[model samples]
Target: MANQVVSLSGETTQPSRADVVIIGGGIMGVSIAYHLASAGVRGVVVIERAALGSGSSAKPLGGVRATFSDPANVALGKRSLDAYKRFGEEFGADIGLRQVGYLFLCRSEAEVLDCEASVAVQNSFGSNSRMISGAEAARINPFLDPEVLLAASFSPQDGYAEPSRAVAAYAAAAQAAGVRFLTGTEVLAVETAAGSIRSVTTNRGTIRTDSVICAAGAWSRHVGQMVGVELPVTPVRRQIGMTRQQPQPYPEVPFTLDLSTTMYFHNYGNGMLLGISNQQAPGFGRDFSFEWLGEFNAAARICAPSLAEPDLEFGWAGLYENTPDHNALIGASDEVSGFFYATGFSGHGFLQGPAVGELVRDLYLGRQGFMDVSTFSVTRFHNDDETLVREVHII
Candidate 1:
């Protein structure tokens, strides 16, 4: 762990030195840096191939909720929610977080039963989530079509936050506490010795560090290959669109998800944000086509008919770092000592960023006595322990 910063593009340049060198400047990487600096881990440097939040962190749908069927996810989400609730007061950055609650519509009786079981697990972890009939769901969200929903799971304490603002706040706070960020620096290789990471070779320069944390999001598998370790992460393309301002008396709404159609939407100022999943293969060549607009509009119409009206404003496509089980691969690996991972979040990274930051920090500092994250280890899949937690309304 050293403190010298060397220019990567210059010839005869010595490697930059840091106690912890984190690859990727997205929410996951930046958040981990923030927590590390907060825990007094000096000489920390985070390198991003592009600008901060330019990856999956910037493109998230911004849905924050603690209503999960898995106990581990519920705990993680609740911890993140608590951190978000106090973000403005603690970091002096207004993240635009709102606790308007989330309404998860259930289209079938089986879905209702599943939601009830999920609610029980959530309540066990002190989450204020519960199951409601379709009539009660209509009362919660006046604009919702009761005929389309059989039941709903409502969590009053969960909501959404501005992704860009959250990333800025974490980066700012970490910078204030002395975390170096190098944007436009891509990690080209991981120098290893005796089965441990010695340094990271990047496009800008080589970074010598005690440890390396791979938080590269969609590109995590590529980064993993650098250390001769295979990461079970893939990039899946997803699209989201926003509608133009419309004159309507819709009440203040939490992020809503239609379980029947896998569509989700939320208030985007005077307009609304809408999106749905694309059943396609993973690749880097697919352009963000306007052809997806038809599918988006149809999904929106089924969930919220008002949004289906004319005048859609903007649309974009992003990648979801998917794993075999729709969960993140956190913690260190035996295959590559001193190389840690916090990737494959399956689109839930933004909301869970803060908690992940703290968890990785604790792991690095040998202070993870309180958190039980044994289930999320990368070895679980290898051991044939594929206990997947399926949250049906992930859009």
Candidate 2:
């Protein structure tokens, strides 16, 4: 179906109808809009509660990698990385995509084996990831404290990008492809009748649409509640801290992940960007805490001594729309027809946003996506299927 969204002439006038109404102006929503438009779907309207890319997509440490424990995630990573590589030429935007690679430091024999196993899976998917000794790891990233490391997995194809810029690129491309964007428009409620999406009521006005894709990121649960669907998605807070630019220059190295402590760091400008995962008491708290700084510093001292400096120049927090299994909920919802989801990516959402958009576009248009998306369906939780693909290499 070629859906065309009628462009709004003025700020007060809302788009009365659209083929597809996508909520959220972040990377996921914008990327989906772009893909759908590029695929010849017209009348695609993206509703953003705020300006584009201002949500969780803006707060990431900007790490993009294919070094995942799950094959599904690895495949998605590979596809997204491919897109990021050509993003500059394709989008006419420099997303600062640097393929400096990703180095994961393991501290124990068991962790070493786990790293080896993940690398094996990653390599099978053409990731070309390999295990390196502590000496080699230090050589790859000289800032690492080599004495405490057992081994590390390095994938040269993986790296980071300017996430906000990437979001802008997708949004611009979508706009140019005839996708209408409704910035500052809040989806008040998604109205349905006869078990199918009828229209979406927004703060501005009503938008009649056949399909509604909830790409609302951290606010997806609340959005799902509008249709009486209980999405198993929660917003977990994650924080990142940056050090003051050093007077002495540090070598630009690969983004390093300390597996044992869940602490990771990489070169950002002349300083370093670092963060850690707090599994306990994960909630909707987006406030940066000094309490966590102490823990992050301790981990940094052990893993990367150079980043152990007490003076954290600045820090911020963002929420990850996480699911129980830490995998994304892609495809249409089983409960409501025409209601689709491309959210709940845990922390990997920003990295996988583009590929996911393309995948969703494929499924929506009744075409085979780049990969099998059966593993990411929303019905898996409904079918009482307990054997979910649990991602091990998350930080």
Candidate 3:
């Protein structure tokens, strides 16, 4: 089954037909489009309501890691991490990937146990993650308060990258391979018949296609409803703050995270970036709030006391497409033919995007994937007896 997408003079005009209509021009859509096009599939159209990588993809300084307790997540992160390392070589894009590693601070005995367990799983996958003492953590990042830490987990391969660069790289590569992208085109509805997709209606025009890939990120649930599929994804606002250039030059440090509160900090430019998980604030609100700063500062005081001294500027606020288990929703729908999805990755989407692209390609081609994607099925949540998946190491 071959597909084709026709483009006019510029990228603004939407093609009336395509082999595949991918909703979302973020990391997942671009990656999947690249993989599909490079795999000899054509007529692919990626529709983004905003500019490429302008959504959640443009937000955070992307973190790439494999230090996860869940084996599937570890594999996905590991695969994507490997891809990110070679992104510059393959895609001709310098993503500014500095593999300074990830350091997780644990404050209690139970947290230490969980850290050890997570490291054990990570090491099993050849991630080379290990549990370290508070002193060792302090040695890695001098800004830390070593006196209060119990133990920490460190993975040398885990690091951060420039997301916009990666997104541009993938999108450019995909587009060069004859993929048409329609930016500022919102998907209004998905017309379906006989349990299969017919066309994807957008604000600009209609794209006639049997296959519709919902890579809509935080807005995935609304997209799912258009096709009578219930994608259990909720958008929760997460924020990060950046400190102005420090008076003293800051040393390069690992992506350090406090285990209890999921508060994290890493070296950025002359200063650093800090963030915390605000499970209290919910919804699609991308508005930056000062209300959460007090809680973040409180956590930073116990985790890394020195971070409190610097005046931090509120950074970007993006939505995390959360599921009940905080994992991901990836798979083809059984009921709705030609509907594939790779979304709801919580905060691990950027790191896992590459591997997920491969997974989605495999699913679309009816081939075997590198990892068992059975656990990531969208139907798992509906099964009462099923044990839901959870990615414990979140930062």
Candidate 4:
């Protein structure tokens, strides 16, 4: 198996030439490979530094929603939601898609207005997201402290899923569709000639490919750098913790998020998985900080008072590939002909993976995509035009 990689589908021999070589074996890469294979393009190869979904994809809170301020994001999310719903049936894999809904608490009038505006944007894209009063919020989620909340946004159509399982499902489907996934392989360099990607150099060996998609999540910048494209993605550390299994299981609840502190939590297995955004400068640090524990406790007390009691059974940190605007950078590169970007999703990459993969496949095949991804182009940052896509719900 030296020159071959084994996937759930079967043995995939190391290829000498591939039609497309996606950098990153996370959900984005596998999804792209799957969509491409489904489109009848078989020579697809996915290179992963570690195991699939081992990066930021593994650490997502798994909140899948279309309640976004950006129209492109909302459209992409709606498509992703549809794909996720049909995945289990189409691929014979249960993604554990629980439509528990997403409840966002807004404390201030401004935040409430923002939520209203975002809901409007989402609704325009066929998403049934709406702003609800505190009473309504409480009606949907009984455990919430409605008195403290000024307003909230709830979308029953939006929900959460098992991230690792989704990744595995996509990888399996992609492989079964004849996509080769090479794990434990680091891409050392991307060789280009005549303004197009020629091949990719990896730790194991070189694979010749005309197309390359940088879906490396937190490490996408490094992969882009190899091809002389400076991706605006920065890896920021976000911490998450889970409480011990309660003697009495928690009541079924939506994934609740506090707008003020960006603190969020939802049911995960037998424990409640919770996390908060770090205000410090962004870096590649993945070490979980004890200093964040106090902040988490304080935030939890206000947003989820019942979870205030200290019983942190486990904790970990992961990177958020953030851009200047926090919206994802998708589409083809302006400088490189065969290079594509599906990175800088901020914190919503996991939710957007399925749709983005299809979008990338469409773009690569020169077919019109399900949604117009012009707003997510990398040239947005450099262009003189002020019309750029911005996501208000970055949490």
Best by TM-score: 3
Q: Where does model 3 exceed 4 Å of error?
A: 1-9
Give the Cα-based TM-score of candidate 3 against the true structure.
0.95
Candidate 1 wrongly placed segments (more than 4 Å): 1-15, 247-250, 300-303, 386-393
Alpha-carbon local distance difference test for all models: 0.80, 0.83, 0.85, 0.82
> Candidate 2, clashing residue pairs?
3-42, 3-43, 4-42, 4-43, 5-43
What value does the lDDT take at residue 87 in candidate 4? 79
Q: lDDT score of model 3?
A: 0.85
Error of 3 at 304 (Å): 1.2
What would the per-residue lDDT of candidate 4 be over residues 71-158, giving only the tens digit for each residue?
7888888889998899778878877788888899999999999889888888888888788998888878776788889999988888
Estimated TM-score for each candidate: 0.92, 0.94, 0.95, 0.94
| Better-scoring candidate (TM-score), 1 or 4 | 4
User: Which model scores highest in lDDT?
Assistant: 3
Pairs that collide in candidate 4 are none
lDDT of 3 at 307: 82
lDDT of 3 by residue, 1-109 (tens): 0011122245447888899988998889999999999899999999888788877887648789998888888999999999999998998888889899999889989
Instruction: Give the Å error, residue 235, model 2.
Output: 0.7
Question: What value of lDDT does candidate 1 attain over all alpha carbons?
Answer: 0.80
Residues 145-207, candidate 1: write the lDDT tens digits.
787888899999998887777788888888888888887677888989989889988887787
Kindly provide the TM-score of model 1 when superposed on the true structure, using C-alpha atoms: 0.92
